[model samples]
Target: MSDWIDEIKSQLPAGRVLTDLADRSSYSFDASFGQYIPEAVVQAKDKEEVVHVLKVANRWKVPVYTRGQGTCLSGGPLPVHGGIVLDISQWPREIEVKADDLTVVVSPSVLTARIDEEAAKHGLMYPPDPSSAHVATIGGNLAENSGGPRGLKYGVTKDFVLGLEVVTPEGEVIRTGGGTIKNVTGIDMTKLLVGSEGTLGVITEATLKLVPKPPEVQTLMAVFDEVRLAGQAISKTLTSGVLPSKMEFMDKACIRAVESFYPSGLPTDAEAVVLVELDGHPEALEVEAKLVQDVMEDIGARETKIAQSKEEAQEMWHARKQVSPAIAQIKPTKVSEDATVPRSKIPEMIERLRGIKEKHNVEIVVFGHAGDGNLHPNVLCDQRDQEEMKRVEDAVEAIFEAAIELGGTLSGEHGIGTMKAPFMERELGKVGVSMLKRMKDAWDPNGIMNPGKIFPEEGQKLVLRDE
Candidate 1:
């Protein structure tokens, strides 16, 4: 063991630092591709322990990859470099809701859904509810700036974050933003670190903004015989003055997979289905629901069904939540990519996805937050087949190109970890990426904070198959 490892163990509790291969191997990979073993794993429970671990790692010029629940779809917590895996998931969970101020102070280890559950006690709501909120930690959500179906109307995780208590890469403690809703004291460092994928600093604590719970919510499911018409209906409804709190889309492949996996009463025969949720006053929702129904029908929807009761509405959303696990059962390997385009270009983007699927001969199931144009086009294949995996890689690259070509982005909710790093320059341009690199270099001078992420290596390309 190195002096740094000894120092970390000495500083933290007796059982906090794990140098055994079994423990290290457990922290190797996350939800995304690739696996890398770290030399040591440190479970820091509090801010002081985090500071100590970072100080020792920084002094030793060792890479420190901070991780939460390891539920990141974009590979945010994968420790690609062999150094220290700073595991924060073991930290004690803390959630303090200030009802009067409409804010919540929480520890990094708190489950993302717990914040909203606590807020609900005070008739308040935390809007950024990611699908993995029940399993994911707030630290990981902040690191990746996660999004959910509600993101179409409420925005992503970054929008709800009012402040953060961060531990710098060099082990210095600094507070950015505050508990207040509006703070223009200086630079917006909170926004910078929120979506940075943990390259700049490690978040110890955070203050999140909360909103009042909606009085009523109505659910609507629109069936389409054609995929293009489904895309067109999404754009038309958003423009028709009825903004839904949640607008999700599912292709026939996803619908069938969900039905087969969990038996959600979804129409497998339809080409596509658009699920809509409108929230607000009951009277307004009643008016908005009708408007949305009319818009869907006018835009070529074959049928529109409105949930008659809250239980029915819950079932609809629950079925949508099951899309990920449902589709996973279709194939042994699922390559989930979130390539987002503009609302007006959604129809075209779907067309491009179809073309890419046919051209590459890959099985792709489309489903995601359609109102925001963040589509999750998943390619299902057997990774053991090298030839098919190669085709999947090419198909993934084509998806990225199509998004950028249509004035869209490489990722909307998922952060650009190693999986999408190679295509960063394509979306941000050379100069734009260079500016980001300069900022990253300044914040992490030793490059010890989560290296080999966001920025690609010289010849790195999208490789899913084992080399």
Candidate 2:
């Protein structure tokens, strides 16, 4: 073992440091592609423990990868050049809600869903609802700037974060932002670190902003015969002055997959389904619901179903939630990409995705928070087949190109971990990426924090298959 590992063990409590191969192997892979076994895994339970691990790793110039629940779909926490995996998921969960101030201070280990659940008791709500809220930790969500259906109206994790207590790469503790809503005291370091994919620092605690729970929420499902029509309906409804709390899109492939997996009453015959949720005063939602319905019908929706009750609405959403798991049943491996475009270009983006699918001859399933133009286009394939995996990699690259061509980003919510590193320059260009690297260098001078991420290494390419 290295001297840094010994030093970390000396500082942290016994049994918190794992050097066994079995224990190390457990942290090798996350929900995303690639696997790398770290030399050691350190379970940090508090700020002091995180500080010690980072200090040792930084002193030795060893890479330190911060991780939460390992539910990252974009390889955010994977230890590519691993020395120590700082596992904060084991940290004691804390969710302290200050209802009067509409803010919640929480430990990084707290599950993202629990924050909202705690806030609900105070008649408040945490708006950033990532799909993995129940399984993923708040630290991971904050690191990746995760987004979900609610992101259309409420924004992503970064927007809700009012303050953060993060440990710098060299083990320096710093607090950015504060409990109040407005804080322009200095540089917006909170925003910079939130979506940094753990390249800059490790977050220990966070203060999240909450909002009063909506009085009423109405759900509507719009079924379209043509995929493009569904996209048009989403764009039209957003412009029609009825902004929904949640607007999700799922294509025929996703619908059929859900029905096959969970037997939801989704119309498998429809080419696409646009699920909309409007929340506000009951009276306003009633009018907004009608207006949205008219827009959907006018835009060529064959059938528009308004959720009659909360149960009905839950059922509709339950089906939408099943899209991911259901689609996974189609193939052994799923390459999920959140390639987002502008709202006006949604229809065209859908058309382009279709073209890419047909051109590449791959099974592509599309679904996501479409109201924000963030579409999750998944490519299903068997990784065992190298020939097919190569094609899948090519198809994924083409998908990134298509999104950038349409004035969109390579990633909407998922941060640029190893999966999207190679394409950073494609979207940001050389100069933009260089500026980001300069900022990163200024933050972590030794480059021991989450190495081999965000900024691409020389000659790096997206390789999903083994050598």
Candidate 3:
């Protein structure tokens, strides 16, 4: 470790490499509590420096992990192998908004919201607005193929990524896709690396597609007597041809949690709530808003309120954004799962999640992008309670199984990092899992780039064993 650290230090600037335990501990984990201290952390300033670090690590047979702001909830950035974490948040950010081309060229470390702000200057916008946009890097967003409230209408990060500059596992740089709108050039490597979660390559720069900013926007909140009614309302809204930019849901438990955090006049007695946002021309938005309201009322919504101003709309969104933190306040630890199903099956999936909570005797707060059928059922528990933690794990597995059975996926935006890699086989059949492993081997022949993640192991271990 000392020899490798010295070699890396000699290659880069004097202070770019860090081995201090305090700094190392800071890079150990992401937003999730999972932690694995790396032997060293290097904050790379340029693509050349990243190549230097990767080449040295490859030569020394040391594991290398790339990280952004460390805000990953799926543990994608966790340095589980404890070798080197190539912190990319320090990389230079440059956003070039080419209005004529309807695209933007941005550095990997650029914040998602900053791109939107910059695009807005040119009357344009990038629509994959993840909840963590304020802090998450564009590179991390592409790595996970992140989606958020707007995904129901504008789609996810993958839809907007037109091109990328990536560094392969062998420290070779390559460009995939470009500023052009359409490309049928080759194997579509850009899309493949977009959601590979750094196991395939490190994204240094990206070209993102942009759309015209909507002239008008409106938000509406509908309260339901039961959660199923809210789900039905969501189905009705989509079926009615009103493509809301944001369609979110929160159950009673989640609403109460948010109320406790910010008593913003949320209906405490309601069993469920749906927050919807429409963006387009004012005349069209008005028509769509009425259609949504009528559908919600027809679906048995107890009450509905439409935001009259942008400030009120922001306030409504603030309540939804407070969910994770609010649930965290209920317990020291939280296990958040992003299981998505068919839009029509959301109610049934929610019911199954309720059953899991009752069976395990644990509190589960549910909320997420209802229109897209992505639900985040967060199980709050104390990690110190061994027995309870075991039950939580079992409950999570049951939830994943239920989602799969309902034609859903184990994850919506969060990649299959170490946390979900064990269940990759359960989601993807044996042949499917093997195919993924073969692809990983082909890309990373030396098995050095973020190993033990996104692929099932050979011995068929159901869980990852610390090496």
Candidate 4:
């Protein structure tokens, strides 16, 4: 292994290959749980470097885990098999906004939000705005097919991607899709790799489609006496033929946490708050805003507050954005699970989360894009407490089961890195899992690309505590 690593060193630029235990330790883990030190760390800055690393890794049958900003919540970048961590975060940021074509070409290392920032100059927008867009690299977002609040109106990363430059598991550089808006030519490899979690190949560059930026936007907040009512409000608003730009939800625990963490004007006494944003023409927004307000009230909302000023609206969104950090302040560790259900089942999912929390004795905070049914049911706890963590694990499993039972998915935006691998069979079934395995085996015959992820091993279970 050391010999092959040495060979990888000789191919790349000086100091590009890091052999120091301290450096490898840095690439060992990501924002998710679990850690495994890699045998080496490759700070690949260009496509050639990526090709070189993959070629050497494939030849030696060494596992290669491609990583970006490491903001993955599903252990997407964790080097579980201990081979190499190809760190691409430091790769030069490159973003070229083709305003005329309503598209953008970007290097994998570019920050996801930066693409939108550049697109804004041309009155265009990149709609897939993940919560970590400002920090997470586009490469990672593409890998996880991450989604944010805007995903309610627009789609996830897979929907916006026009094409991709991927380094195959065998180290061959291949291009998929094109800059055009529509292309039915051959297999859709671009979509295939977008959410594969870096198991199939390594993404070096991507061409993304952008949309016209909405000129005006309005914000509305609906206060509910019960969390279930807030869920109903989301379904009601969407079914009212008033598709909001974003519809977010936060439970009582999340509301209080955000207020305490940032001292926002949120009503901490409310059982839940459904924050809504409408975009497009100002006049049309006013009309749609009223309709949304009516639906909220009819759905049993105690009160509905429409922001009169931009600052007020921003303050409302800022509170919503503060949910993750706010909840983090409540506990040392957060088992953030994005088990999404049908839009109609948001209330039922909330009910299930409450029951699971009570049954497992875990402190669970529920929130996320309610309009699309991609809810973030986070279990807050201390990882140091083994007994509590065991409960948390059970609670997490129950949440996934509930979502799947309701015709939802194991993950909405978060990839099934390691946390959800154990249950892949439960959702995909034996045949489906076997078909996916065949595809993976065909792509990476040596099984050297992001091993021990997505597909579970013989006996892989969710373990959060440091055992």
Q: In model 2, what is the error at residue 324, expressed in angstroms?
A: 1.3
lDDT values for all models: 0.92, 0.92, 0.88, 0.92
TM-score of 4: 0.98
Kindly indicate the candidate among 3 and 4 with the higher TM-score.
Answer: 4
Return the TM-score for candidate 2, rounded to 2 decimals: 0.98
- Residues 157-211 of candidate 1 have per-residue lDDT tens digits of 9999999999999999999999899899988999999999999989999999999
Candidate order by lDDT, highest to lowest?
Answer: 1, 4, 2, 3
Taking all chains together, each candidate's TM-score versus the true structure is 0.98, 0.98, 0.96, 0.98
List model 2 lDDT by residue over 1-467, tens digit each.
Answer: 78888899898876989999999999999988999999999999988888888888888999999999998887878889978898998899999999999999999999999999999999999999998899999999989999888999999999999999999998999999999999998889999888999999999999999999998999999999998888888888888877899889998899999999999799889999999999999999999999999999998999998989999999999999998889888999999899999988888888888888998889999998899999999999998989988988999999999999999999998878999999999999999999999999999999999999998999999998877
Off by over 4 Å in 3: 458-467
TM-score of candidate 1 versus the correct structure, residues matched by position: 0.98
Pairs of residues clashing in candidate 1: none
Q: Cα deviation of 410 in candidate 2 (Å)?
A: 0.4
Model 4 poorest ten-residue lDDT run: 228-237
For model 1, where is the 10-residue window of minimal lDDT?
71-80
How far is 404's C-alpha from truth in model 2 (Å)? 0.1
